[model samples]
Target: MERLHKLFIYRKKLVRPYIEQLLKWMDIITYVMSALLIMTLVYEHGFLISFQEIGVINRLYHIVWVVFLVDTTLHLLLNYSDTRRKYRGLAWLLSVMLYLTLIPVVFHEPEIQGGIHTFWAFFNSRLYHVILLTLLSLLQLSNGIVRLLGRRTNPSLIFASSFLIFILIGAALLMLPRATYHGISFIDALFTATSATCVTGLVSVDVSSTFTPEGLFIIIMLIQIGGLGVMTLTSFFAMFFMGNTSLYNQLVVRDMVSSQSLSSLLSTLLYILGFTLAIEAAGMGIIFLGIHGTMDMTVREELAFSAFHSISAFCNAGFSTLPGNLGNEMVMHGHNTIYITISFLIILGGIGFPILVNLYETVTYEVKRIWHHYIKGNKRMRRKIHLYNLNTRIVLIMTAILLIVGTVVIVVLEWNNAFAGMSPTDKWVQAFFNATCPRTAGFSSVGMTTFSMQTLLLMVILMMIGGGTQSTAGGVKVNVFAVVMLNLRAILIGADKVTIFNRELSHDSIRRSNATLILYLLVVFAGIFSLSLLEPQASIMALVFECTSALSTVGSSLDLTPTLGSDSKLIIIILMFVGRVGVLTLMSSIIKQKKITKYRYPSDNIIIN
Candidate 1:
């Protein structure tokens, strides 16, 4: 009778965890909860190692998770001694429990008369082995968060932190009375949050049917916050409240959003926010006016839809409440006017904050100063209030070139392919929108799956180039692209210095640009390779296009994201984070700095082709 009672108590405990409902580091708590769920599954399914069994493969993955977790925990404890000390009592107990649980594997006996490795013996252990591994992934996440917190000035880190926080908030919102549904899992919530925060348009469920207006609004909020960056908003408020700015904060904003200088950092942020709101609000009004006359929705619904799409369009965030993703319904209903308006928003939003600021200042000042001179002031006495920097010039010039080139190339390539059946005007419009949107803005009037390989490749290139610096768009950056072009031109001309607009480029700037380019390419390749391993049957171009889109935060996909398994989705998430924050920032945060030396190293030249 006592044994039966004890068993009942233990079984009850199995279903319900003993941990209290604490919201300290909620993200870490959720992550740990997920790992525990995986552990429970392993414990339920006893170890049955066989090469052909999918269960065995999955079990091994869990085991690997364990080992990885341990290494991560040890590193965290060693590096973050302060945290360890603060939780010394719990740390000591956890340390002892950790080793004790691994003792069986550590001292396991080998099978007699067989040449089995000792490590393989540990692998054959029961499913309870995951307990140790669960702690490892948790530790890794914790350590990463701690390290990120240390580099608070980094723009990428600020964006990443915001993405994480918004995701948690979005998840909580979905779990409320309105958002929950039969098929919605917490994992799905997390995935959706990641997609919105990263501005990747991969949807696992039918977004229109599955999410309610409240839920959809949460998503739109995440996309808008994620698109402009959380820090960008916070920084604006900080400047507003303090009525004074610090150089340190300026540096933070500059690094966070890729700004050019400290002089107009606050103004730049204000302009970005103001410009974004104005454009999106205008877009919503335009769409509402254009569609309310004929659309099926009620007045409230129309207003809601207009507002949601306006934010999404300006943010380059491709989430839609309509099914099939902005299909021919809008066009057939004569709401094509909204499409053109959205295209304008996308183009303007994709132009980097720096370019936008410089353009505004230059044009506004030039016009005012010219008028002043014509109104009886000496023309020679006129002084320009705004000066365009090299970075600004490069971004503006390259952006114009890219927009024209991308439009022309897309039109030419799709002329005989996807655009074959459309009328001349519609074809041109579709091609133009496609050319602009895929670079960062993810809205699509045409089906991505129907595009030819050439068109897809062209999109991949455009997405990879992305938008301008410090803008809502992602990519290696237009300034970097411009610098590379200049460097190539210099090489071809046998010049020692790369100069543009009669001004010589700084070596440091060139080096940083080169580093950014190389790192971005490497990260993209890594994503491609990882995805390929998980999805062997997927096409190379499809994979490349998908990878590029995710890496550039351009949400266009060839109907691949929804079909990808958990592992593939995880890889995509990592790439999206990297792409949005930028590869160079991530690399700088990870790479340990070396000590400076007084002596200069000898220089040498290597032979080239």
Candidate 2:
């Protein structure tokens, strides 16, 4: 026994260094394979598939798959304890899948041709092989992104760069021959790609009529990635599979999710993804049920519509599979349930993930405390809990106030104008949707151009206010709007400090908010001015609406979007990019300003006003 123990120890010592070296090489090889796999998928699906090319594609796919399988197996074996501890059943499931993928290799030719034999033969068929390869490709792609992100430090830069990369890739894919029914220009593809990647949903061409199924799928993927933020998704996969999240990674995640502490970063990420999927799934079911028998679509088509709209609504992307967007009779009439459910999803998504996490923790804590007090008869367990943070309080209060006031304002202004032909119920529903949509959702149940000038102006304001920070929604952000308002109120009241919920707002926070607001306005004004010059035939009101929509990342647009000059579209694209990545973040990423100064400067006051 002693001799065996000594031998085991010696073996482990010798293998440790070699395992580490192998892992480094595996990382590089895995990334390269993932890129190759993506290229393969693009080539196969983007163009006409020839019978002769099938064999070559199959061989390349098989080689990449074998490498991935081996790499994953070795990784699991080398870090079994860590993998098991982190993923537990997931690790076992992956192992099972890997083994299952090898069945075709093991049994190249089966003698039997019926019953179970037939099933096995089908499983080993080319169709199954492609499906398996596709799954492996997605895994490798995710793994590659995670590894790449882990090596980066600046979370803001990574966040910005990831969107740019996704936009470029999406554009390239959309330009493929099979992606669009009629071949699209590169600029149009780039616009569509940026629109999808930024989750802005502003399209130069009609999505439903122009893009093929494959192109639509790519657009959906971009929306999902854009809405969730690439860094969050990549990090979740990394922490889930690797379980070796470094402190630097934790720090970056902490900032990205606006997490209060490093310890809860991983849990927070899990909650974000879990909540998103859960909400989207529930929305999908309701939407599917609502639109099933009403539309002319088959089961598969209805399912795709539900999934696409559910994702788009939850992401606040505003992309609809229907030609007329939400204004289509299919969604606005018998599908009232779809409209209401989508509205709920828009609200939930626009509310921000950090706020969702806060609500989750608060509810869970309170539930546990109540259960302990009632069931266990322990008064000590029911100690007072301060569940709401300042940010959460401010966001919730602002969001509620905005939604309520905006709804009321819209209902009143459009009661006789835009709501003239609709029933009271439909009127109220459309009014509520308009209110929420401008909170960066971008969906509209009524024609935007038909609205009264008052309603249109109100929409511009609501779009400008937008939703919360660290959310898929974009604008000046609710927090920034709140801060700016509080500051203005304090100035009017002659208060020395901006205070909210008995907490003094920090100087830096106020400054950043003010700067962001000013910069946002400047960009909007500049965009409007430029568009006016480029498209002189467009009305001033339409120009302002489009500019605000673009700057706020609200995809709503007048009929002008499709008719704009290339210069105007380019301006909108730039606005969408800036809006998705905040003005402040984009500025910081571009110009690396020093965070602190070594020396202090004297302050001087200049009289004005």
Highest lDDT model number? 2
Question: Model 1: residues >4 Å from true position, as ranges?
Answer: 1-159, 175-177, 180-183, 242-247, 254-265, 374-387
lDDT of 1 by residue, 492-580 (tens): 99999999888999999899989988988898899999999999989888899888888888888888888888888888878877887
TM-score of 1: 0.71
Model 2 local distance difference test score? 0.85
Q: Please write out the lDDT profile of model 2 over residues 1-609, one tens digit for every residue.
A: 999999999999998999889877986787787778779878988999889898888898888877878777877889766556655354456557667767766766667777767767775777766666565556556656655556874667777898999999999999998889988888899999988888887889998889999999999999999999988887776666546555767777778888779877778888999999999999999999998888989999999999999999999899987888888876667667887898899888898999999899889988898888999888876465568888889999999899889889999999999889788888888888899998877776788988889888998999999988988898999999999999999999999999987899999999999999999999999999999999999999999999899889889988789998888899999999999999999888888667787988899999968
Off by over 4 Å in 2: 1-26, 69-96, 99-143, 148-152, 375-380, 383-385
**Pairs of residues clashing in candidate 2:** none
- Model 1, residue 293: C-alpha shift (Å): 1.5
| Model 1, residue 332: C-alpha shift (Å) | 5.0
Residue range with the least summed lDDT across 10 consecutive positions in model 1:
18-27
